[model samples]
Target: MLFRQFFDAESSTYTYLLASGRGREAVIIDPVKEQAQQYLTAIEQMDLKLVRAIDTHTHADHITALGDLRAATQCVTLMGEFTQAECVSDHVREDDIVDVDGIRLRALYTPGHTNESFSFVLQPERPEAVFTGDVLLIRGTGRTDFQGGDPHRSWDSITNKLFRLPEETIVWPAHDYKGWTASSIAEEKAHNPRLAGKTEAEYVDIMNNLNLPDPKMMDIAVPANLACGRG
Candidate 1:
């Protein structure tokens, strides 16, 4: 399998490119609009056909590249079924498999950061790697203060769905404020301060009182993402 992780410094967002191999079909997850050209360049260089561009949910931080990639490559644009984004070509639900050549990603409906948020588990060959979107970060979790976010649901999604995976599973989150790149389920379970030993109620209280400011681009990004980042 071929996998490359790309980072957008502006938003601290991470975009992922995955394919079975050179000349095979490929898919991108959580793409940033500003990096669309770069993504296309990489796909062309790899001799891979871009088949799908997926977003875990509507983002509030930056515009998504789904629309741009679709326009350029005619790739299907995918989002969770619960998303309000009307321009997505495919609305995947829990347990749905998103296939591209030899690759298969099983959609897991793990909402928390957003109502439509999902985590995609690469199947068959790479079941140990999960694209967690913004649900679970390296040592922290996404804020659940807006966009139908529920701290309790976030906690459930982590303890019930994500933590259920094997200890060796690799977690790839959507954004990272720190320089960290990837983390394993075991590492997070043991070291993630937010989840390590806290009860559900305690986690809820912590999330509710975070008092963090909204993303700088929320107003623009939200409406634009709903249109598939046309703005």
Candidate 2:
């Protein structure tokens, strides 16, 4: 298993590259549209075959490179199974195992940031990690204020699903507010400042009280993303 993490400073989003050590086949997760060359160069230099480009959900930060990657490498495009299918060639389901050459990731549908969101668990000695799209972040969680974002649903997913994971499991979130990298479930439970032992009503109350603005890139990203990168 080979892995690399790329952070786009502008949006604070993290892109991950996971390649199969055996066959050199790779998958790109949440790539930035502005940096197609970076993604291509990395794969090209290693002589790896690009198989899939996946977005944990429709992004509110930046346009994704799925279409660009497909045009260049002919890789399959993937997203949450609940999202509209036109954009996602592969609709990933909960517990569905995605095999990329030698690396196999077990999918866990963790919907909080969005009803369609998912978190992937990479197996083996359990590297004790999961790629959490927007649900569980270093200091905060994704806002439940958009099209598919619901405060109640988010509370359920975090408390019932995500928080139930091993306390030691490391979390790689989609974006970090303060430029942090990874965090542990134990750390979040102890200091998340949001979930803790609060009731769902309290969680919703807090979210309702926040007059947060929409993501800067949402106006451009949503339409284009839904059209599968025609934007």
Candidate 3:
């Protein structure tokens, strides 16, 4: 397998590119518009064709590269079925499989950072990794304060849905502010301050009382992302 992780320092966003191997079809997740050229360069250098570009949810922090990548490579743009981003060329339902050049990701509807959020499990037949957009993070969880967010749902999604995956499945979150790279299901379950030993009520309380400020780009990013970054 061929994989690359790109970081957008400006937004603390992590973009992922994956392929079965060089010269094969590929997919990208949570791409940042500002880094479109960088992804293109890597794709070209690897002799891979970009077949799919996916956004796990409508991000409020940064504009997406979906539109740019599609225009550049004619790739299909995708999001979960519940997304309001009609600009996406395709939508996957829960348990739907996304296969590109032998790499498969099973879509999981795990909303609550946003009502429309979705996470993808790589090689779902025997899970290897999970791309958790914002619902589940390395050590903390996403803020359930806007975009139809709810603390109760966040708790349910993380504990009941994500935590059920294989303990060793690698966790790849969309954003990380403290320079941490990645974590595993077992690691998060064992040490995550927000979820480790907390009950559902306690988890909900934590999410509800985060008291964090909105992303600086929310005002612009949300609208732009709804249009697949062309807004």
Candidate 4:
């Protein structure tokens, strides 16, 4: 399998490129608009066809490259079924399988940061990799103070959905502000300050009191992302 992780310093966002092999169909996840050209270059260099561009949910921090990639490569634009993005070509639900060549990812509706937030778990053969988009971060969790966010729901999603994965499952989050790249289910369960030993109520209280400020680009990014980042 071919995998590449790209970082955008401005938003601390991580974009992922996945393909079974060179010259084959590929998929990109949580792409940033400014990095569209970079993604195109990588695809061209690998001699691969971009078959799909997926966003876990509507983003409030950075514009997505889904629309741009679709325009350039004719790839299908996808989002979770509950997303408000009207321009996506596909709306995936829980358990839905997204495939590109020999690679497959099963959609897991792990809503927390946003109502439509989702995490993609690599299929049966590679159950060890999970793309946790903004829902889980290294040592911390996504703030649930806005965008229809509910602290209780966030706690439930973490303890029930994500925690069910095997201990060794690799966690690749959408954003990481601490210069950390990846983590494991085991590591997070044992060390994540947000979830380690807290009960549901305690976790809810912690999230509710975070008092985090809104993202700097929320005003522009949210509106643009609702249109699939066409702006």
lDDT of 1 by residue, 91-204 (tens): 998989998997899999998899889999988355768999998999999999999999999999999999988889999999999899999999999999999999999999
Question: How does each model score on TM-score?
Answer: 0.98, 0.93, 0.99, 0.98
Q: Which is the leading candidate under lDDT?
A: 3
Who is ahead in lDDT, 1 or 4? 1
State the lDDT at 104 in candidate 2.
73
Output the number of the TM-score-best candidate: 3
Candidate 2 positional error at 230, Å: 3.5
Candidate 4: minimum summed lDDT over ten consecutive residues — where?
121-130
Ranking by lDDT: 3, 1, 4, 2
Cα lDDT tens digits for candidate 2, 37-109? 8999989887889998888888877888888898899999898788763766787898888888867777778
Q: Candidate 1: what lDDT?
A: 0.94
List the pairs of residues colliding in candidate 3. none
Clashing residue pairs in candidate 4, if any?
none
Least well predicted 10-residue stretch by lDDT in candidate 1: 121-130
TM-score for model 2? 0.93
Error of 4 at 217 (Å): 0.4
Per-residue CA lDDT of model 3 for 15-37, tens digit only, reads: 99999999999999999999999
